[model samples]
Target: MALSLSARLPSCSSSVFEKAHKLTTQPPILPFPSNLAACGCTLLPASMGVARRRRQVVGAVEEQHNQTSVLAPKQSPSYSSSKLVLVIGASGGVGQLVVASLLSRNIKTRLLLRDPSKAISLFGLQDENTLEVREGDTRNQNDLDPTIFDGVTHIICCTGTTAFPSKRWDGDNTPERVDWEGIRNLVLALPPTLERLVLVSSIGVTKYNVLPWSIMNLFGVLKFKKMGEDFVRSSVVPFTIIRAGRLTDGPYTSYDLNTLLKATAGKRRAVILSQGDKLVGEVSRLVVAEACIQALDLECTKRKIYEINSVEI
Candidate 1:
């Protein structure tokens, strides 16, 4: 498989500078003294000299701007008003970032969370057309009503739990219940005309029974994740699966949408994208969240499975 490596840089508000051609002028060759002529040099008029100096300064500024543009993040075009994206697990790490980014782009967003009140605390109040929060849990098939997906063009599922049992497993939300059963229920509830479904899964699912992965899968997290992936593959809905490596960066659970929008990968901004289950290492949660959003519109990503990782650059 081909390797897709990308660098994520901080965005700048500076406008792009147009390339400026070098300004050249031939100074009139005037008569000179014998000693001056010996060097074969001609002096430019005082005004021309000043003009050249100004050009040099302008050229330097343009060069700096060009460099900044190369390092700046690409601004994504605003999505169409018709695009209503429903985000499952909207309060989770990657999910929150996805929601914040979609809102920033002015895309209509619908969030399904177990606690509807959390939406107000996280994203604040918004117009009904811009954001709609519904109360539901994927673990309960009854909550996967068709109306929850009405007018939703895209769905991003970021729900998942810890590999080892912990407080997250409270209320019987185990790997089998949340990862496998929850995803299965969600996919089944998707509409036939859905534009796309981006599922966030982990890297070691394919190798869960192997050595170190087996240790992490002792509680069957990886196994259930793979089961969820298979279910989506068999479904009629167009889908993309992003298997992220060990996730780094913040969950930012306490922060509001404004803070989540500003979250960065710090030094770990270079991304490694590949097919198969070959890539190993860590990826920033922000990178994973961005990938899920990007995949929604890229035709080439449809029905594809990608393994992602990141490195400090």
Candidate 2:
């Protein structure tokens, strides 16, 4: 009877089946194999086989459950609905545009700023169901609540001062305070596994310029930005640093798609001239937002930097 039971059990996927097959003993008798002619010793082989298959199916189900539970955390976003993005500095110039772009994509957004009232006024009536505004100061580590960033997959920071102390992008830029400490505090608070990060910084900060006027220019602006960039790059978190040249308040427009992507390859730089470049260009904002999402999706832009400039498409 046991021989009949072993022969009837369907094969399992792994080599464990070979061992099961090698066992010569009359496999342990099933408790309820009743139709086998009243006496266990006289049970029909067919009836015993059916009971064996039932047991096989039960064991298979349990094995599958264990495998799935072990693999759940390792699965990628391609297989899951778990996506959370935290856009810091949502109250600022570029941040507002970023927030709008995120909403347009129908993604739930969490904005962390020093004040929620300013953001509420800027964003107007938001879909209470998706938009969440959490008040937190990035510069103050104690003020940052990890719970606010709990499930965040991407962190986009457009948190630098728009103008230097002298009202220039480079003039009297406080790299130590806003760019250095502020960014350091924020990065320190982030989890090592937080994958995507996009930081909006100014181009031309590769050199030093103590002059009040020059300090607002890229040369001076770069120092502070470099500090922040260094912190982000050194951290375990993957980062994307975007150095934008000469921000203006110009109109929105699109660019040649291929040309835009091509620009990222070489260490090329373009001046965002006042004529066509403005901080409010709809195309630029859209492009930056799209690039950010693509970076997270492709997993190719990890730990890289790129620059954005205005040019004729």
Q: Pick the candidate with the highest lDDT.
A: 1
Which stretches of model 1 miss by more than 4 angstroms? 1-79
TM-score of each: 0.76, 0.58
Off-target runs (Cα >4 Å) in candidate 2 are: 1-81, 166-174, 209-220, 250-286
Supply every candidate's count of residue pairs whose N, Cα or C atoms clash at under 3 angstroms. Answer: 0, 13
Worst 10 residues of 1 by lDDT: 14-23
Local accuracy of candidate 1 as per-residue lDDT tens digits, 15-105: 0000001112221111222222111122222224444644433433332332311112335444456799999989988887788777766
Best by TM-score: 1
Q: What is the lDDT of residue 174 in candidate 2?
A: 57
State the C-alpha lDDT per candidate.
0.70, 0.49
